[model samples]
Target chain A: MRNLLAAILFACAAWPAQAQLSIEITGAGGQRIAIAVAPLAGEGALLDGANASISAIVRADLERSGLFRGLEVPRLVPQLTEASSVNYAEWRSRLADTLVLGSVAARPDGRFEVRFRLYDVVRQVALGGVAYTLTREQVRATAHRIADYVYEKLTGEKGVFSTRIAYVVKRGERFELQVADADGANEQAMLVSAEPIISPAWSPDGRRLAYVSFQNKKPIVYVQDIEVPKQQIVANFKGSNSAPAWSPDGRRLALVLTRDGNSQIYLINPDGSNLQRLTRSSGIDTEPFFSPDGQWLFFTSDRGGSPQIYRMPAAGGDAQRVTFEGSYNVSPRVSPDGKNLAFIMRDGSRFQAALLDLNTRQVQVLTDSDLDESPSFAPNGRQILLATIIAGRGVLTSVSADGRVKQRLTVSAADVREPAWGPLNK
Target chain B: MRALWIVLIASALAACATTQTPDTQPPAGVEDRAPGATRPAPGTQSVPSTPVTGVDLSAGRPASDAGNPLRDPASILSQRSVYYDFDKYDIGDEFKPVIEAHAKYLREHGVVKMLIQGNTDERGSREYNIALGQRRAEGVKRMLLLLGAREEQVEAVSLGEEKPKETGHDEEAWARNRRSDMLYPGEY
Candidate 1:
């Protein structure tokens, strides 16, 4: 029976020499569908130490999408974290929409091989799989890519599992700009500073980070290379220099400057050469982000007697008010898709996360936490990484793109703030 | 520009409903909606729009439709969610009555521009949350449209977990944090 089953599975793996397999996920009606991923299994190779960790990360990403339910029961039929034997009836009883089973094995030559398949339980058939060769470092990413593919197939939207997040972790009074995997793993301090670090913005290509640091005790804006670990002053104006935002093409930086006395909006080249002031407001003007199309610059201003969101052309034009329903609105981060603007709106006594549509300009409050600030968008613009005060300490938090799945992120013992979530870094 | 100024004033009044909390307050959806009943019937009374005349705020329009302006807006915040679990954008069954009442008022009124700020607790990444918040706001907007809220009158936004009303470090706070708020002209 075992030999016959093995032959059947082997035939299935090579069934069609060039099978054009594709997987698609629909039926999201705002629901987190349950899924079960069996551990990986393959021939002539075996997973060494820590392969289990990689599978766990992939599972966490899917379950956290808040769009898929993952089975994590111990007594559950032995599921492969990669390719596994058939246990269809067991999972079907548990209401699983999809089953992900794959295998990873180590070759004697110190290389790795991976094979995987995604099955739609509702359809009761295979959708997609991969039989490929790779290195150890590439295995986790390949697994993540597979997870992304399966998630997108099921949710009808792109998956952001392969993205990254950049935030400042205060280590013993020193502020460090750190970049890590989207799950806060693989953390590496990108920049270190003695003073406060306010804002961290990402280039469109995820190659560089622009942020405002008080390294010299005075607020200074800097754009640092994410790859080479080099830094340059982007805005070190005479007065206040804070809230650095990168333009879409990564050529310019928009920030809050008080050089003219009262805080106003200013634009500068990434190399810190061309400094052009945008808003001439007598009140406060700060926290500017460019629209995805590079046509408009959205920022916070108090010219209307209270801080609210206003927009102006990137090429210097009269400003148009975008958020008129909130008295205190700041920290405007435009979505990558250019459909909405997320910012801090203080309505009456509520200082919370709120969003505004570009076309309709409607404002909806997204949070109820007190003193929520410094919001950054994910690469897909389907989620946001923000700094919110949790347990009297500033910690990183993430919210789904659709205002579901509020997750409080726990990173270091020190405070974390001003998160700049980059697009998928290749 | 006069018509624009009036509209701006009205919008400003709507915007002014926020901005009066102590900085120490837990940042969440604590927006105090004007009491549902206190708002005078539309068209019966002229709109007391507060234009930016550089005048003292004491002369501003009354900041309440919910009776007492002295009452905290946080006290009136919706204790229940408008969305289903694992769903970022949609009015759940629990909040239907609340949304229905609000929608009923919008149906009676003409094109009144309001911002539906979509929000989520700290869950996913910021960018995705903003989009989710936008989706959540759009979900509410779609519901209102279905219930007679004009499409032109509703705008959507996402503020992914930048604020929260319940500041605890547990599941309950997260629940309160994932929400979308309704914005109006006068009440902050």
Candidate 2:
């Protein structure tokens, strides 16, 4: 099949996902889990766009992680497999409590096994499964690793459904950067540019990605490689190499430079050498962000004269500010259990997507948008993902870290910008 | 770095002595400004102690009849953009004679080489509009190096809010995408 679509474009860095991203989801995440998800049996004899049916992409990745409610598979429940047996009293009398069947076949050395399982059904017991083989361009990464093993075997957390996000879209004056599949489907572009691709980040072993790049006309910082086509540049110095981040031991990066003239916060390394200058503040320290146990960095500063959210000590010195009810906070983002931070506040001229809490400093707000901006969390710190401006274009939303559920995603005419969210593909 | 370029030339000479009456404010948008209206206005307009030479103050042109005064649009060095006010980055005394006619044509063409850029207006956070468009291209490269140009002939970067010119979302396309743009050097 054209050498399997050129080996899925030499193992992922571009393939069928041409604009993709359609999400939508909307609120609802407190008590869902009804489950059901069937249709796997040989996946309608496989091969027609081989992408969508590993139990309909694990029931839309467990109903877009608004915590599962799928349910609707009752044709007297038959094609069950993995040695089918107990109907669990007709899937707990159709209210389902949990079911998830699966099976794809096609293996005579051509690869595509699949499998799935996961039951429980009011305790008819099974809650286990596993299979995969893969090909057919990894059937949506084996249905997001079987919806991250049925969302960590039914919500004990840890399930960013095979993580991967990174955004930026533009379209007209071009842009691009992409990288999808955290339910926005398989998108892939990894750097297209005419100029402008803002702060993308994600490098804690989810492979690579860093970002910034106003082509070479200004904001530099690069770092590619999320499965090949390589990249590099890691900060081109002299005024505006923008907010890059990464440091959770993927060995340094933090960014935002102006080469020593204001937009401060430095750090470097990912091959751009040990630059180090971490915030000197004559004000405007520019979104640094790290704190996932890499000690602390979390940035964005108008040095207290407006743009807030601070933090410091990841080898830097005495800073500590962290958003005080918004005079216009900025993009901070910490959370992957660094206990919440997320940012972008501004509230009256309306910039939205707030969240703070890092141990009771409280905050919350989450999105009533009029222009939010790259918030990004979800490695399992439960949702977040940002980038707003709805009616006038640019989308990609997500929410839930108690801001209920939300979702969005868009991309029919392109605009989406800097999202990030990778790292749990492990 | 030279005390952040002398605190960005004392806040671009205090926002060029309080915006040189750009119609007494109240219009530029982006959080309405007005609080103590940017101080420094005791009499206004004054950073001009010389460097006017080839004269083109708003295009009265005479830089020896502009053979290349930045491709002469009647030459105020063809007024290569300066605008601002709206999360302000200063240099307003009405663009200071087109940045002193391109800082006297880059101090009489000492191997010219400009390139300012800076831009904003797509509202909030693209890395804080890239540090507010590198403080509006380092406040027009510190007013073209305090009007005589050459801190190695200017470089200043930022295209934050990512190159808009006018992709409209109101406030007259964000007042022409908050400004700075200079360019020169085979017009990059």
Candidate 3:
């Protein structure tokens, strides 16, 4: 019996070697579908070889989802780019349940056309095919869109590849608010200042960011257009004006302002008018976040003498405490499904990312880092992005919603923090 | 006595004008001498100029000031920072005397203005820390106001976790960073 147990352990260790990308999915709670993406065929130069770049990005997106395992397929005879030319027997032997093949061509009008086909190997049928006509600049976005399409078709749920992440990067005395792709690529600084920048909250439409900037030598909330680079101070109250969280409909923002004696949650229009107070706690009340339905607003408050997560009506009412397991829980970010709350919970002097199931009232710590904060959930509710300290430098990290598939994103020679994953691009 | 006051005012204005222009040299015997330095007999007793009344005008005063109580290490006003526990903005009993002393000073000198900067340790959400730090600064501001400091005399702002007194990540560093610092205008 001991030898049998040893053999079982050996098999567990050896099973991961069978896959090309050994994606360790810990808490997915389902069988991972095996998918293989063949290299795309192209004729001429397509933005530094678009065929390879596009397929790699698609494979990476699927693998990072923690729901799919990319299988290794050896170069087969007559590399197939079309669905009708695929040999089901060959891919079935390679053990890939789903296969993706594509080809790219540069058009005469400085545009590129990328066509892809998805095949079900075991069923010997074509799942689908799509052709995207995009400019050179839109190639990466088109790749993410294709990945989203494939993911939705396979998982029956929308993918988050088309989403963007906004974060604050501090290098020396300069601070930059940067927006990057979901996979931490194509970073573009939206705002740069000598003073500190914090709390980058993406608008519901993914076109604007509301963040706290110290450019005026005081913490003030500014809603900046991500594309046009224009900004207006949404909360420049006398005292501290910070912690901007947008409503789901993108019309309003719930923020924490200390204009009145102490810090309290207040709702304001995106145009910086029609101010309405939301919470009336005498203690420190801040970090206001709206539920996906826009009916409830979850926030962090210390009114009970200790910081904890609380929720109240979006219009305003009494706040009911939600978290009780830990003495310290703050920065509650509700998931897109409105069923889970991602927050930072103090654990023996170390703050870590945690998720609370709204239905079961069970809290699960999602990270083991010594200092983790600003837990923002992906639009699809499958991942949580947070800021953590690694080797004394602040870096951005993401963990799957179920506490699986962790990834660290670091900017060289800079400290990155306060990462807010934006809504899915429409 | 009236002539002495007029001479003091004239000398103060001359000192201000001299300091404002970079190329202007100090008048004769006042050349680069420290404040309160005694000069040799030249028929005129060089009265040192004080920019702000009742405030120390000297630079790099010793931490253990034995002459001036305002700069003395033992003076309550010298203790300019009030520290707090992790994520708690409540004023501790130990720091009440220190704050009361500053409040008394501010009230006695009605023209004195101070900026209260609240800071938090490097932990938790950055924006939330801003609120936490602001509460700490406001806590001190409330106490100062209750003790008779004018509301306009004190401007409270939160640096959040951006500025740290100590850069380490341990409890000691965090304890030192979670503090509210009292600053006179132009001090920062």
Q: What lDDT score goes with residue A230 in model 2?
A: 74
Local accuracy of candidate 1 as per-residue lDDT tens digits, A1-426: 446444543443332222111112222326777787755544214345645444566677786666777787443344364445556676688777788777677767777777778888877888877766777666567667777888778777777777777887754445667777675556766765544565677887887888766556455778888778787988886545766777777788887665665556778888989898887765556667788899998876657765567889988889888877745567788887889888887665445787787788677777767757778777777777777776768676777666776667754456677777888646
What does candidate 3's lDDT look like per residue over A1-426, in tens digits? 446444543443232221111123334425778999886776234556534477777888888787888876555545557544877787888899999988888888888889998888878888898999987677678889989989998888899999989888777555778888887767777876657788899888899999989878898999999888877989898988888899988999999888887789999998999999888878888889999999999988888988889999999888999999778888899999999999999877779999899999988999888899888898988889888899999888889887867777777777888889999888
Query: What is candidate 2's TM-score against the reference?
Result: 0.36
Candidate 1's residue-wise lDDT over B1-188, tens digit each? Answer: 67766665555444323333221223333333343222112211111233323232234434442343222232222221353333234455656665665677677777656666666765433333443455576677778788988877766544445444554644445555566767665422
Best of the candidates, DockQ: 3
lDDT of each: 0.63, 0.75, 0.78
Give model 3's docking category: incorrect
Off by over 4 Å in 3: A1-31, A49-52, A72-78, B1-75
Model 3 C-alpha lDDT per residue in residues B1-188, reported as the tens digit of each score: 67766665555434322121111111234232232222222211112222333334244444344455454443456567776767778787767887888899999999989999999989877767888888889889999999999998999999999877567776656666787888775456
Q: What DockQ does each prediction reach against the true complex?
A: 0.01, 0.18, 0.22
Error of 1 at A156 (Å): 2.1
User: TM-score: which is higher, 1 or 3?
Assistant: 3
